[model samples]
Target: MRTDHMLSMIDDFNGAGFEQVDLMAPIQFDVSVRYLKEDPWERVRQISRRLPNSKVRALIRSRNLAAFDFLPHDVIDAWVDRLVANGVKVIGAFDGLNDIDNISRALVRAKEHGVETFGAVSFCESPVHTDELFVAKAQELIEKADVDAIMLKDAGGLLTPDRIRTLVPALKSVMGDRVLEVHTHSLTGLAPLVCLEAVELGADAIHLSVAPLSSGNGQPSTQSVVRDLRALGYVVNVDDERVDAISNRIREIAEEEGKPLGEPVEYNGLHYMHQTPGGMLSNFKSQLETAGLSDRYDELLHEVARVRKELAYPIMITPFAQFVGTQAVMNVMAGERYKVVPNEIKKYVLGYYGTLLAEIEPELREKIIANGASDIRLEPSEPAPMLPSLQERYPDEDLDTWLLRAQFAGSQVDEMKKTVAEGGNADEIPQPYFGLIKALYEKSEDGQQHLKFGDLAISLDKSK
Candidate 1:
């Protein structure tokens, strides 16, 4: 989630009398973090202070610790420490490969910090991502990582009712009374049904977003989910009026910003083949449009499928999704596959980021290596030691500012500071001119008014 949207969502939910909501904190390697004008951590800290009843949850990429590559233990420790200190209450840790070793240390640290640790299984489809594999991973999270809860994360909205019917039971059997949560997207238009199946089969909590921000590229609408759950004789604690208010506020903001409103998408058959999350799909479209190749989008989607196959079906999530999508774009533009493979793709093929679920075809692997792809060894760099560099670069700033500078470019950090100075708190809602006019109308006994400001003139009729 972007920092501003997240803060606004939190405030809206809180104002609606919702006791608690778990927000997905920005991932350490989130590209959005780099573009944000203000320090995301500072925003998080402010939200933590403003909404004491809410819980903040961050999605940790296991050993990667939110970065593209595996982080050293010290780095992981520092990241978790910062999150805990900033008031994050839950850490949802998962490895793309469902590798328990990748997740254990982070989960253990979160548990040590007294934060709820949810060991997540990154949901995907392939021969390797079998039901048994997910169950085994969940068992490892419980027995090895000792996580407080288990989460099934369907990042691509790939889970269906048929699959959930068996998968949920399989997971529940092994979980043995442990809290289980389901987090899925609405990309496939199956998330609501999948969520229902999960809850029916014993999921304790289901992640959802409020309407206007939910559905299309986001989670299913909380109102829709709660309505269905209640229809099925489930007890939904949320107030309908509050949900409506939050949705109305979000709708207004979306309209003002010209952002797309979340709506139920028609089922597309190709979604099963590509499994690209809605956000990534939108990004791919925007990038393609910017390059004047918008007409070739369908071709690029086909190329993505082909690329995913060649790369041995890495889960369609960050880093991997970016790698595959970027390569696909290049292939489509260059008119030749592997005409230009990115360094990230090369590193991925060389096993620098962890083992792929399936092996890259030897012929393709050879071609990439022949095209100047060499194994890049990663050095173990401790994050704490980087503080000195940050201190030197941003002398007058606090630790939060320094941290943002360390994560992003200095220019972006400066812009964020400037934005804050300009009274642009992401949490502050803009008062619409219509609201002022309505207030004036309410105060006027005649229910009509006329006003003029220099050359500008305005009139209002409340009766109309």
Candidate 2:
């Protein structure tokens, strides 16, 4: 979630008389690199301080430990410790490939910090991704990793009703009364249906967002889901009145700020092809437009599929998504595939980020190697620790601040500190509606702004 959305969701939850709400916080690496230039945890700390009753959880990329590169045990430990200290009560840890080694270490650290862990099976579609595979993965998370629960994390919204019906039951059978949660997005327009099917098959919880912030590429609507569940004779604990109020407020704010409201998108086959998350797609569009190649957006989308396959079908999430999308953009713009392979991709092909579930084609692997990709000479045993250097740089700062500086650029940390020192909460600031009206007025040649509401028309003159 974005910082502003996190703040607003907390406020909405409190106002709605809810005693607790589970928040799926974004990964720190994603926030620092993709979302914000500064320390993203500043807002997290604020929210945690304000909402004592709410449970804040973070999504962890098990192998990378919230980074593009594989991090050492000490770095992982420090990251988990800081997150727990700041606000995160639970960590939903998962590997892009269902590699137990990738997740077990992080889960152990999370437990050491007294943070609950939800081991996840990253849902995808391929010959390797099957109901049996997920069931076995869930069992491993329970028996080996000792996670408190298991989450079927469908990052790509690839779960269909038929698949959910079979998969949910299989997972439950292996879980043997362990808690099961379903988390999926609406990219393929099947999340709501899949969510219902999961619940019917005995999922303990479902991740949802309030309307206006729900649907589209986001989660299914909490209120709508509640309604459906109740209609099916299931008892839901949420307050309908509060849900309505929160939705209304969100709608108002979206309108005032000219932000797009969450609406159902028609099922686009292209989404299935590339499996790019909604936010990543938006980022790709923005980057392409800035480069004056927005006209090739459709072409770029097609390239993503080819690139992903060539790279051996990386689960379209996080660092991998960025890596594949970036390489695709480069390929499209350069008009030649694999002409400029990123360092991350090179490292990936060399098994730095853990073994790929499927093999990269022999020809493609050789091509990547021929094009300057080489195996990094790091320890074959484990990732190198980053904390020692981090400690050296920020000798005086506490762990939380040190971690922020370590993850983000120093200037971003300074800017964040300045913002906090100035007693400014960017999320709390309302949209400048009057400034928008003034801009509209300025744009009108006659010094009169014309407005239309359905068939009704009105005019506002500067003189008046």
The residue-by-residue lDDT of candidate 2 on 21-59, one tens digit each, is 554344644454344443566666777776775577786
**What value of lDDT does candidate 2 attain over all alpha carbons?**
0.76
Among the numbered candidates, top lDDT falls to 2
Candidate 1, which segments miss by more than 4 Å at Cα?
A: 1-12, 15-20, 27-36, 63-72, 286-295, 373-385, 391-397, 425-464
Model 1 / residue 434 / CA error / Å: 9.5
TM value for model 1: 0.84
Looking at model 1, residue 172 earns an lDDT score of 89
RMSD of each: 5.0, 6.1
**How many clashes (backbone N, Cα, C below 3 Å) per candidate?**
1, 0
